[model samples]
Target: MLSLFTIISFVSIRLAMQHLTSLFKCQVFTALVCLLLMGLPGQSYAGKILVYPVDGSHWLNMNILLLELHKHGHELTVVRSSNSWYVPEQTKHYTSITIPTSHASNLEDPEYMAAFLKRNIEIRSRDRSLSSFVALQQQTLTLLMEAHNASAHMVRDILHNKELVKSLKNARYDMMLTDPGFAGGVVLGRYLELPMVFNVRWITNSEGHFAIAPSPLSYIPTIGSHVSDKMTFVNKLKNLLHYSIGQYIDHGITRPLYQGVISEFIDPNTNIYSLMQGADLWLMRVDFVFEFPRPTMPNVVYMGGFHCKPSKPLPPGLEEFMQSSGEHGVVIMSLGTLLGSLESEISEIIAAAFARLPQKVIWRHLGERPSAVGSNTLLVDWLPQNDLLGHPKTRAFVTHGGTNGIYEAIYHGVPMLGLPLIFDQFDNMVRLTSRGVAKVLEVTALDVDTFTQALRDILDKEKPYRENIRRMSQLHHDQPMKPLDTAIFWLEFVMRHKGAAHLRTESYKMPWYAYHNVDVLAFLLGSITAVALLFLLTCRGLCRVACRKRPRDKKTKDKVQ
Candidate 1:
C-alpha cells in the first residue's frame, strides 16, 4: 500500500510541474505578441499637434486637416484669438487656447474687417489706373502692418504667459502646424524649437516663394498678376516688375514690421523668411488645375481641396428652397467671410440680375436685405456653401472667387461667375476664366445690364463651362486618396520620418542669384570677356611689333643702298 501511494504522488507532482511550465510559456508568448503589436503601424504612434490659426477662415482650413489627424488618434491643440470663429462642439479631440487681445478681437469682428475692406474697395472703385493700383498696394500694406502689430501684441502676451508656456513645454508637442498668414507661427515655432509645417492659405507670396523654392519671376506669376506660366513678353515683363515690387514691399516694409514684432519674443537675429525656410513642409493651398504649372520642391505638397468633404444634409430652409426649385435648379451667391456685404449699389445690381434668372438665388447677405431682391432670390445670413454646391439642383455659383469657394465649386462641378473683390481673388478669377470654367466681372464697372448678361451667359449660354468644371472636378477627385487624406498622410509621414529633412530642397538655403544660377551666367560672361580682352591685347602687340620691324627693315635697306 505504501509503494502504490508513493508512485501516485510522484505522477501527480510531475503533472503539476508540467502545468506550471506551460503557463509560464503562455505568459512569455503573450508578452512577445503584445510588444510586437505595439510596435506595428497604427498601434502606438499618437502625437500631440499644436495649431496656430489667424482667424476664422484660417481656422476652417486647419481644422479640416487636424480633424483627420484627431480621428487617427492624435491630440490637437489650437491657439486662437478670443474673437475668432467658434469651435465646433463635435471637435472633442481639439483643445482651444485663447490669447486675450482687444486688438485681435476687433480685427476678427465682421464689421471691423468689412470696414477695412470697404475702404480699399471704395478707393479701387474711384480710381482704376496705375495710381489706384499703387495706392491699393500701399493701403494693403498699411492694413497688413496694423494687423501684424496686433498679432505681435497677441503673440507677446502668449509668450509672456509663463503658465501657458510651462504647460505647453510639459506637453511636449510633436509638431507645430500653422497657416503662416500672420507669420506668428514662425516666431512661435522658433521659440519652441519645434518642427513646423506651413499651411499656405493662397498661392504663396512671391517673396515667400522665392525663399522656399525656385520661383522664377520670368515664368511664375506674382500673387495678383493674373497671368499664366506661359506668358507673353509683355506679361513676362509685368511678372518680373510685379515680382520686384512685391519683393521690395515684403523686404522693405513687411519684413521690418514682422521683425519688430517677432524680435520681442524670440532671437532678434531670426527673420521670418529664415524661420519659414526652416519649415519641414509647405502644404500649399493650390493645385495644378487652378495654378500654373511650375516646379515645386519635394517638401511642398499641393492640397488644394483639403477643405472639401462629403456633403451633409442642408439646413431645412436651404433644403426646402433647393427642392422647390424643380428643373430650374438653384444659384449660390456669396462674397465669403471677408466682405460682409456689398455696396448698396452693387447689391441692387446683383439683385436685379438674379431676379431675371430662372434659377432660384440663395444669396449670402449680411447687411440689410436689399430692396431690389425679387421673389426668386432668397437672402440669408449664412449658407452651407459646400453642401449647396454638392446638391444636384445647384446650377451656378456667383462668388468672390476666394480660394475655398473656388475649390468647393470645382469639387461639386458647379460653374461660376466670379466678381473678385480683393487681393488674390482677382487672380483666382482670371485662372478660372482662362480655363473656360468661369466668367469674371469687374465690381467697379458692374452695371445691372452687364451683371444680368454675365449671369445669363454662365447659366444659359455656357454649357462648356459646366462640362469643363465637371472634368476638373473629376481630375481633382481622381487620386489615390482624397485631398484631406493626402494631407493627413503627409502630416503623419512627417511625424513618422522625423521632419522629412531629406525632402527639403537645397534652394531654400541658397541666395536668390545662386538659386536661379544667375551667378553661373555671370561667371560665363566674365570668362568670355576676359578671353576677348586677352586676344585683343595679343593682336595689338603683334601689330605694334610688325610696324616697328618694317620701319627698321626700310632704314637698313636705305643705308645699304
Candidate 2:
C-alpha cells in the first residue's frame, strides 16, 4: 500500500512540472506579442508615404526607412529627378516617378560637379583670410541658390505635368517625406495639403533649428563651424557672429527664391516662414556620440546609422586582397560620391603613402590610375564600402569625412584617417579627432610624407582608437531598437497619430530673439536703466537740499552774532 502511494505521488509531480513548462512558454509568446503591439499601436492600418530625396546620397539614406515601411504594408512612392542616384530596381517597394529637372540637366555631368568643387576648394585654400572666408561663403550661397532654383523648376514642371498631377490627385498620399535642403518639398506639401516630414541627411542647419526646434548657438555649434559644444570666449563670439550674419545672408538670398517657387503653385501671399515652418517632424541622421550634447525637441528624432547593416560576405577579389594582408590587415580608402575622382597630384600622394604601408590598400579611384601605385595597392572604380569596413582584416579607414562614411566607420568599429576636403567634411573630422578615434589631414597640404605619417599614426595608435570606437559602437547599438527600426516606428506613429503636432516645440513659433530669450534680457536691461536713473535723480535732489540748508544756517548764525 505504501509503494503504490509513493508511485502515484511521483507521477503527479511530473505532470505538474510539464504543465508549468507549457504555461511559461505561453507567457513568453504573449510577452513578445505585447512588445510588438507596443511598438506599432495600429499594426493593421497603413498609409501612403511620398518621398523626395535631395540627391543620390540622400536617396540612399532614405532607402532603409522606405523598405521598412513597405515591409509593414505601407504604399511608398518616390519622385526622382533625372539625376537621381537611386535606380528603380534598388527601391523594390517604391513606385518611381521620374521628372525632368533643370538642376539635373545642369549637373548631369559628374565631371562638371567635381571640377566645380575642386575649384572652390582651391580658391578657399589659396587664401585663408577673412575676406576669403567671406568670398567662400558667398560662393556657397550662390551655389545653393542655383540648386534651389533647379528644385523650383522641377516643381513647376511637375505641377504642369497633366498626367502626373492627375495621378497625384487620385493617390492622396498621407504624408510627404522630404529633404529640408530642397525647398521644392515645401511647395509640394502645400500643394498636396499633406503634412511634411524632413529627413535631414546632415547636421541640423540654422533654418531647420529656427523652424523646427531651438538649437542654442551657445551650446550647439553652427553647422560647419568646426567648434564643439564647449566653446572658448572667442569661439562663442565667433559662433554667434557666424549664426547671426549667416542666417541673415541665407534668408535674404533664399526667401525670394522660396517665394518665387511658392507663388507658382500655392498662395503667393502665404508667408514663406509658414511654409518653411510646416514641418511636422525632422529625422536627422546624427548620433549623440558624434554630436555634442544639446537640447533637442521631441519632434526631432536622431536616426543615426539608419543606413548601417550587418556585414555581408565580401566579393572574392576583395576578400582575397584583404586576406593577403594577413596579420598586417587592410586599409580602405574612398573619397565618397561627390568627389569621385581625385586630382592626379593628390592621387599620387595617396598612392605613394599607401605604397610605404605594410597594410594592403583598397583605393576607390575614378581618375586615371596613379603611376605611383604599389603592388600592395588595388585601385577600383567602385568599392563595397560597408562590407569592407566590416571585414575582420580591415585595419583603418582613410575617408573624405562624408557623414555617411563617418557613421559607417564608427558602426564597424574602424578608426579613421580623415582627408576632409569641403563643406561639413572639416567639421566631421574635427568631431572625430576630438573623440580621439581619428586624425585629420588637410587635402590642400597633403604630401606623400604627411599622408604616410597620418596613416602610420592611426595604425600605431590602433589599440586606443579601436577601443574608443568600440565604446561608441556599443553606445550606438545599445538602443531599444535598431536605428532604422526606430525611424520606421516613429514614421508609422506619426501616420497613426495624424501628425506629431503635440511633439513640436513652441519655440518654432517664437521669433529669433524670443526663442533665445533676448527679449527677456532686453526687459531686464531696461528695468535696470530705469532704476539707475531714479537713483541718480534722488542723489542730485539730496545734494541740492543739503547745499541750500547750509547757506541758510550760516546766514542765520551771522545775524545772531
Q: For residues 167-210, what per-residue lDDT tens digits would candidate 2 score against the true structure?
A: 88789888898886766776787788787788884422353554
- Model number with the top TM-score: 1
Model 1 residue runs over 4 Å out of place are 1-43, 82-91, 100-107, 153-167, 207-210, 260-270, 517-561
The estimated TM-scores of all candidates read 0.84, 0.82
Candidate lDDT scores, in order, read: 0.80, 0.79
Which run of 10 residues does model 2 get worst, by summed lDDT?
201-210
- Please identify model 2 stretches exceeding 4 Å from their true place: 1-43, 82-91, 101-109, 159-167, 201-210, 263-273, 461-463, 510-561
Q: Deviation in angstroms for 410 in model 1?
A: 0.8
lDDT of 1 at 406: 94
Whose lDDT is greatest here?
1
**RMSD in Å for all candidates:** 5.9, 6.2
Candidate 1 TM-score versus the reference: 0.84
